[model samples]
Target: MTNAGAEGEPPLDAESLAFLNRPGLTRLWAAARTRLERGGLQPTGTIRLQNLDAQEREALSLLLARPVTGPTATIRLPDLDIRLRASAVGRGLAATLAELGPPLTDRRAARNAAQAERIRLWSAAETTLAATPLAGQPWARPWLEEIRRGGTLTRQPSGTALTTVTQAIDTLATLFPGTTPGPAPATWGRGELATRTTGSAHGLDDGTLLARLVLRGIAAARGADVPTDAPGRRALWRRASVIPDEVSSTVLTYGLRPRGGTWGEKTLRERADRALETHLTLRELRTLRLNMPPGTRVHVCENPRVVEAAADAGCTAPLVCTSGSATTVVLTLLDALATAGCAFAYHGDFDWTGIALANRIMERYRAEPWRMTAADYEYLATRAELHGTPSLPLAGPQVAAVWDAELAPIMEAFGVALHEECALEPLLGDLE
Candidate 1:
């Protein structure tokens, strides 16, 4: 292996170093050093210089004491060693170059050492995985492959990648907390897990290596592409029953009068009486005494504007609006409502992505269509056309509207997207 040279070696005298560092002779010495490192310390083979400018040719001629006339110059390794030993450098080319530039390195030896280390690290990793619940699982293979191919472990700041591998695997095992097969266990918060596992509450913060590593395993097990956006990442964490950010990730509501006296419930009641929208954070959802009381109707929309418009119109009914992509917290609230036997009706934009979101929401929450039908889309598009409003081309991958099969085909044929804001009138009318 090559080492950093200057630390242990005695400094070469300035005059001996100056000869190798001359401006015109710089490239010549570099080529010579490259040959030594790749070929090993003992000088052999030849160094070739191509496209020599006037200054380099003059310097070469001066050093060799022979008139050099070609565009290319070649120096035999043994000949140069003998030449340098006889010069003021007073050492062979290996020692001379070592003194002048970075230390001499054996490229082949370094490569062999690196390959051996990688094998050792991966073996150690497999052994560690074997000790966990993930042992012998098919999904574990993908997790192992992801880290190995992505160099996740090797990129660690210290030898801690292995130690981190252990910590991360242990943390991941506990992620699917209810796997014990009975009444499901209570879900864990990120801070609680981080504090217990890492001795620091912030240890699993987003973008932290530990969080990213754990997420890779989750993605691998799900056979899904690793999520790149915050919403996608947080959604993956939620699958393991981890609430990423209870206080920040929230569901927006208007006119929800859950009878619970808890702060979250009371806030909703107050906001509704005053005809205002309330943002219900995931943290509050845990403490709320009332959430979609049995037989109550719950309306879900894709945009916040519909909720705001409902509040403005003094429509006092249970309404939830997923501000954009329905987040983990939004799903949490919906899960709570579903458990309480609330009826669900969902609506979103008529775009491809919106249809996809609607599919998940309706299927998971058993929601009926809330003016989110093909007829609704056709009406909106025709109205816009009459008003001279251009239809925006649908973007993103096509998603089947499982709730209404005809919806996607019509949207595809129309080749335009109609957002919920365009349908605000009827949605608000329904709430009223």
Candidate 2:
């Protein structure tokens, strides 16, 4: 019989096979493993083994039943198969290698897997960044750098969930008053804004994951605090005219009397202890038709406490509290007042967020900066420093103060926060 006659005999036992695959011929084994993983073992195929040692050459000589020439040898798979069947007591070369050790992964396959993973992460990040309104603004670069450092706004791991976040941000960004004064910021019903921006009304509803990502980004861009509750989120959205859940998003005012309504007039007359805490909704503001006497100065405050104090002092200051960020209703009233040639004097907390709000208010309503100046901040900061109360650290993102350019530097130097309440006594004195 030929040397290949033993077809029914069992292959070498596991222990002998293990010794055969030990460190000596590791390079040859690795080459065979790659070939097997890429394109399964077959007769008439060739594989090259490099840097062969004496032990490896001997192993190869025994396996192939032929002498190897040198350090490198291109072994024919068919020849190895015949040799393995005849001498190694195996059916084929594949069966012999299987008895030797575990299978190895192809290097090319591993590289492709890694490349695909990188693509997925970048695709999600790029999509979200491009959709944010700040994408074209100065803050976009730093914000993107923050994201690239693995500060993901959404905890979602799936591509579909991240894409949903991107869509929501796009919807909200489109609502922020566009630069260069195009069409008025699209103030639609909450549902309408979602549908127009993303193709579904429920896409940006409150309590959703997408909603949280969008809200956080909005607060970041505006240098405002990250809202914690439903009311807080609504206030943030309203500030941008995004109007998420518009019906519930209302602006609180103490003394806002427009010429159209007898009630508005009545509210203005019944000032003092009977302050009108009018809460105007999105729908009401959109359809609102009110006018004020020309050159009227409407005093705007950031806090309800200031407005409440103004009302209690019986100051008759024509005060309007933005409550937090100016909601759609506040903006609507201010816009109407501006149309009738009313001037606005806005005051807010003396901090980064406050300065940002002051800038936005003055720019939008052509309002003058009221007690929101370098002098104002410096006076408050100096008093606090002298009294051993250094004020809270200047937190939130840095924003430039166009109204008083030096105000930003003074705030940075002092690292103090002067809230509207801190200067409440002086503000009330001004009202009188």
The clash count of every prediction, one per candidate, is 0, 0
> Can you give the TM-score per candidate against the true fold?
0.57, 0.49
Can you write out model 1's per-residue Cα lDDT over 1-432, one digit (the tens) per residue? 222234545555676566567788899888888888888667899888999999899988876667778899988889888877787756778877776766789897877777777787888888877777677557775687778898867766436877777778777766643333121155778888888778889988998888988888777666677899776887787766777876867788777777776777777788889999888776677667665566999899999888878877899778988877777778877878788778889999888878888888988888999998878888888899899997799887777888778878888888889989999988888887
State the lDDT at 145 in candidate 1: 74
TM-score of 1: 0.57
Q: After superposition, how far is residue 189 of candidate 1 from its true place, in Å?
A: 1.7
Per-residue lDDT of candidate 2, residues 326-421 (tens digit): 656677667766887878888999888888888889899878888888888899889888898746888987788888888888888888888888
* Candidate 2 to truth, TM: 0.49
What stretches of model 2 exceed 4 Å from their correct place? 1-245, 260-273
Cα lDDT, all candidates: 0.78, 0.68
Q: Which stretches of candidate 1 lie over 4 Å from their true place?
A: 1-14, 104-106, 176-186, 222-225, 248-269, 272-279, 282-432
Candidate with the greatest lDDT versus the true structure: 1
> Candidate 2 overall Cα lDDT vs. reference?
0.68
